[model samples]
Each structure stands twice: as C-alpha cells, then as structure tokens.
Target: MIQIQEPKSPWEIVHMDWVTALPPGGDRSYNACLVLVDRYSKTPMFLPCHKDDTAMDTAIMIWNKVISHTGLFQNIISDRDPKFTSALWTNLHNLFGTKLSFSTAYHPQTDGLAERMIQTLEDMIRRFCAYGLEFKDSDGFTHDWCTLIPALELAYKTSIHSSTGKTPAMLEKGWNPRLPYDTLKKDLVDIHPTASSFKIMLDKARHHANRCMQDSFKYAKERWDKSHKPPDFKIGDLVLVSTLNFNNIKGPKKLKDSFAGPFMIKALHGPNAVQLELTGELMNKHQTFTVVLIKKLQLK
Candidate 1:
C-alpha cells in the first residue's frame, strides 16, 4: 500500500477532484463541481463548473476561487483527469513551483480525502433536493444547484471533523466561526485577543491539529496494513492483469477471461501500482494497474 504522508501545515498539500454528471443547473448551466480540499486542515472549496470545461478553463476557475484567496500551495494530489494531466495545467503549476501528483489508474484511495469530500457533498445535495428548497442568487435569479453551495460549505466548515477532532474553520483560522445559535444565547460574549496572543493561539491550534492528524493516519495505516501486503513484483517481471475494468471485452463476465496478459512489467509505481508492457488492442487502454489488479505470472 502506498503511504500518504501527513502535511505539516495547512495548505502545504491540496487534493482536487471533480463531481460531474450532475443535472444542469444555474444560469450558466453548471453541470459539475470542482472539489478542492486542503490536506492539513481538511478545509474544502466547491466551485461550480461546466462538465465540458477545458484545462485552461479549470485553471482559471481554480485561480479565481482558491489560489487567489489562499495563495500558492506546495503540492496537489489528484486523479488522472484530462484537465489535470493536460500539458497546460502541468506547465502552469510548474511555473508556480507546485508539484502535481496523480493517483494510479482505478485507484481512488490515493486521493481519498477529495473522494470522501465529494461523497459528503453529494449526500448534502441529495437531501437538499429532496426537501425541494427554493433558493435564489444575489441577482434574484433562482439557481437549482449554485445557490445552495454557500450554505452547504458553511455547514461543512463549521462542523467538527472526525479525523482531526476539529472543525475546518477552527483548524484553518484558529477560531470558531460564530453561528446563528450564538445570537440566541445572551451568555455568549465577543472576546478579541491582541495580535501577538492571536498568533500564539493559532500556533497552538495548528500544533494540536498536526498531532491529531498524525494519530489518525497511524491508526488508519495500521488497520489497512493488517489486511494488505506490499507488492513484490519488480521491473521486467511477467504479470497477469485482471480484466475487471476492461469495457471492450464482450460475453458474460463469468465466461470471459478473468485475467489478461503475461505482460512484462515496465516499471513500478510506488509499492502499490505498476506499468506493464502491453501490446495489441491493450495499447489503447491504460497500461498502469494497481497491484491488487495484477499478479506475478509463473512461467512453465
């Protein structure tokens, strides 16, 4: 299994993914949402986007919604989406001194943070749609999807996260944002600390959050390692890849070949994935396969 390193500070690493195939909504006919999550603080930004947005369009939207507000981050982890893998996107990040890492084909665990966040966002949207709430934008235009984003974002940011034991706003800003419930209680008072004291408090909060994240990662790794073992195949090794993801294969799955190839390994991707020397029609497919989807072939 590939071990994901915990970030030392907020926004040091960010994970990004897109939620697509959504019903077209809003005046702009937005059909997708770009999800970006800070690896350290677990903070998220959900930007409305079109399903067919080009690489340059995605880059511009990210700049306007996230990078412009948070400044430059050190690294970004994402799936091999066309927009993320495009030369334009890679070159732009290279210019900004940011490293881009892509997860292995068919492996979402590498960008688990963003994937989980997307699930949460989808659940919220489903519930909202069920209630059939009517929400309007600042222009007084009714938007089916875009208008609900701000409220959903606020609810997600203000709630305590299970992994960090802190709310995203608390971890990132070092202070809990006031909620409407605070206004109902007369016992609540507004206390503003001095600049130096505020800085000290922020540092303490970050330190605590770091510890919490480390502990969470340790526990998760231990549990995962109990059932998963490291891959042993190396370069030039003969292996057989599972046909689970192949779509071109016809006939009943039970009757179809369970695995294909005796393809030779071209390279190793970390400890969990590998690149294979595939030929024929397979060349049209992704050559990289997760270790679980391939096994070392035993020669007769």
Candidate 2:
C-alpha cells in the first residue's frame, strides 16, 4: 500500500489476490488456475486446484499457504466473493481470531493492490507462455509458471516502491530478499556502502528499512483511516457493510451499491470492531463481512 508504512509484520496490512492461466507447458492443472501473492511478503505461492474446488478447498489452500510461511495476520481484507463468505470458511477463520473485512461490494478500492497485480500477471503470463500450450517441452512450460513468477517477484521488489522508495520485500524484511537476480548481480559494483562486510550490510539494510517503516507509519496511521476513531462495535448491534466490487465493473464507491448488511453483531471485537455471522437470509445468498464499516445500522 503506497499509503502504508513498510510492513514490520505479516498482515500488518497485506493484500490478497487470484490469478489464472493455462497449464504450464506439460502440466495439466485442472482449473488452469492458481492463487498467488500474499500481502505481507508479496511472495507468490502457487495453489493448484480445479474450477470445481469448493469454498472449503479454497480456504484450506489459503490456510496452508499462510500458516506454513507467515502464521496469521491481525486482519484480512477481501472482496465480497462467495467463497470468502462460505459458512464453513468463515467459522474456521473465526477460530483463529483473525479479523476479516469485506471491501465495499462494488468498490474496487477494497482490494486495489490485487487488481493491479492481476493486470501485471496477465501481461507476464502472456509473454512467457506459448499460444494455447503449443510449447516444445515441459521445461519451457514450467519456465513460464515457476521461473517467471520468481522473476516477476524480484522485479517488483527491486523496482521503485511508492511508500519508501524501496521494494516491498525490502521493507518487509529490512533487506532485499535473495532471488535469481542476486546471483546474476556478481558483476555489479556496490555503488553505495551498506557496510564493509556482508553481515554488516544486511544489518544496515534492515535498520534503514525499519527507519523507513517508522517514518511511513507516522504518515500511514494519520492517513490510513482518518476518522476520529475506528468504527464503533457492540454486541448484538445490527450493522451494514460497505464492500468493494472489482469484478468487471468500473465506477466510484459512492455510486456502487456495494453496501450489504443489517446483520446482527455476533460479538464485539476488541473496541471499535465487531464480528457478524450472516443470518439465514444472508447465508442463503452467500455473504461475508467484518464490522469495521458499521456506522450503526440505519434505524427503522
């Protein structure tokens, strides 16, 4: 997030996304799809699955990828997608004590980061993949998925970061993560002095990243949510949610009917937030939401 500080912890403010493509040259992945990109590290983990995968399967895949590498974050902001709101999936996440926020139903700002990444991914996959799996061999096919993903990750990290003028990975780890490009940089000169030795260099980068983070947070917090306070949540309160929708629509949040709710508060979150279990009506249509957006359900 350009407005956020360099992340010091996973899910401090992470982005989530999904991507699709044809099977790597030789591989025959059923769904021709994979979920990639964790907000914290900005790393791509390919979760292979089929189009028929249920909300349970998708949630399990997400849990496997997240816990295996980053444990859990304080919050997860996702779009109002059916799979994200499925009863079984919601119940499981609640068990972990992670706060989940649904972006404005039709508002793209809910998951803007993921939307941008999707565009970049499409361009990358198209460039590396053959026309309709006509590649000469499996080697070439895998090169597109595995090799290209890492390459893109590195490229994205080393590029100009809007938040700190450093890569996202750099901010997260306090140093540029190792990648294929690091090995290829042997011929390069250290134009800037990080430290006299390698260990010292890493320490210096980390320190700088931390400093940048402090500075960034100072601004981010003041700007992150400008209201005087976080939303007011209470037990048994009825609330409406403002969700973002980025499917195929183009519009403004104010104009979007993304707000869906009036669900009863299952419990009050720490202070300014709450937990809501969709009612039979909402569940029948498949709904998911976090209480951060509640401004007190409009009275009858």
TM-score of each: 0.66, 0.50
lDDT of 1: 0.69
- Please give me the total number of clashing residue pairs in predicted model 2: 13
User: Candidate 2's residue-wise lDDT over 1-300, tens digit each?
Assistant: 122234556445544444444554324444334544556555444444565677887777767766666667656655555676788767876897766656543322243345444444444443433343231232332222432333334455555554346666665566776653245344446633322233333333334333433444354445444733545566777777654532323356567667656787776534434556665334543232333445577786
The alpha-carbon root-mean-square deviation between model 2 and the true structure, to one decimal in Å, is 11.8
Best by lDDT: 1
lDDT of each: 0.69, 0.49
In angstroms, the error of model 2 at 163 is 3.2
Best TM-score among the predictions, by candidate number: 1
Model 1 / residue 137 / CA error / Å: 9.4
Q: Per-residue lDDT for 235 in model 2?
A: 71
Can you give the lDDT of residue 190 in candidate 1? Answer: 67
